[model samples]
Target: MRRRPQKPRPTGASQYRINHQIRIPQIRVIGPEGDQLGIMSPDEARDIAVEAGLDLVEVAPTAKPPVCRIMDYGKFRYEQSKKVSSARSARVEIKTLRMRPKTDTHDMETITRKARSFLEKGDKVRFVMRLRGREQAHISLWITKLNAMVETLNDIATVIQTPRIEGRMITATIEPNNSSSQSSSSSSSSAPSTTTSSSSS
Candidate 1:
């Protein structure tokens, strides 16, 4: 009977070939504590890993001779998952709040509170105002409301884009005020004033 070809391994930062799954003939080995073990056949690498009670993992498969490391595979996988999670949480996102030209004071206040919360969390806020039918004719009303909203958030946010009408919507963008404040502080600190004293001969 003809032998079936092995399935290709999955490729990602989290994927790795361990122990018997490593099918290469020769590999460069790294010990459990990260010391180099020189070049060896797969069988020899596996033996060393077994003796040390760890896994032989193909860490750098694209090298001249594949590089394998001896470590606790379970712990390595757990750490990799944590790194991915940390990266995802660190990403900044743009959050949006919708309003209408006729939005009441109470409703606008509620929306503004939500927007402030988003800004405090280091996210950009996009304020969108929708107009319907005859409301589109009075775009200035929406612009006025947007400007007022920007003023309310001035303490924690800086206007990135002024209100502009787009189709039936008016949009404005704002970012965390700390960015502007930090830049201004840095600029002021870098340009210190100098005083010159004249001496009489």
Candidate 2:
């Protein structure tokens, strides 16, 4: 009995068609230095890339004739990975702080400081006040406290979501104050440090 031939396994590099893998007869080619080499046959492009000691890679397959670039494929892939990593690191995160209606002044200050730090770092802050037992009967009082807490950070933050009671909890979201941020940044850059110069007699 004859055995069946196995299919080629998919690979990470399969997303990009390189060199001889590009079956299209013609494509728009970009040189290693990013200069357009005009439309040319895949074989011709492959030859130029070989002369340059690089790979002809298909970057935009959706174009009419497709777009191919001649470059060090390994370096190109590494740069793409770096861009992805940078985007992930630059993403803003939302931080949540929990409290209660009876939280003392010290704890409130701590929470406010933490929220302020988060806002400074360009992250959103979510305030959650959980009501327990008979505390649920007085949501209005809790909302008052929540608003007061928000007011303390008004210089650096703005209320994005007003306090709303959800079941046994009151939630509010706050983000960095754009106006204050701009003013602060401008002032810091414009302000000069004061220093006393000693007179030599």
Give Cα-based local distance difference scores for all models.
0.77, 0.78
Tens digits of per-residue lDDT for model 1, 1-201: 222222335657557888888887799999988899999998898888877777788899999899999887777877977987765544546777887788888888888888898889766788888888999888887798889988999999999799998888898988788755554554444442222211111
| TM-score, prediction 1 | 0.56
Count of clashes in candidate 1:
0
Per-model TM against the reference: 0.56, 0.52
For every model shown, the clashing-pair count is: 0, 0
lDDT (Cα, tens digit) per residue for candidate 2, span 74-177: 77777878987765534545678888889888888888888898789766688888889999988898899999999999999888799999888898988788
Candidate 2 structure lDDT? 0.78
Where model 2 places Cα greater than 4 Å from the true spot, the runs are: 1-30, 33-86, 179-201
Candidate 1 residue spans exceeding 4 A from truth? 1-27, 31-36, 39-66, 70-86, 179-201
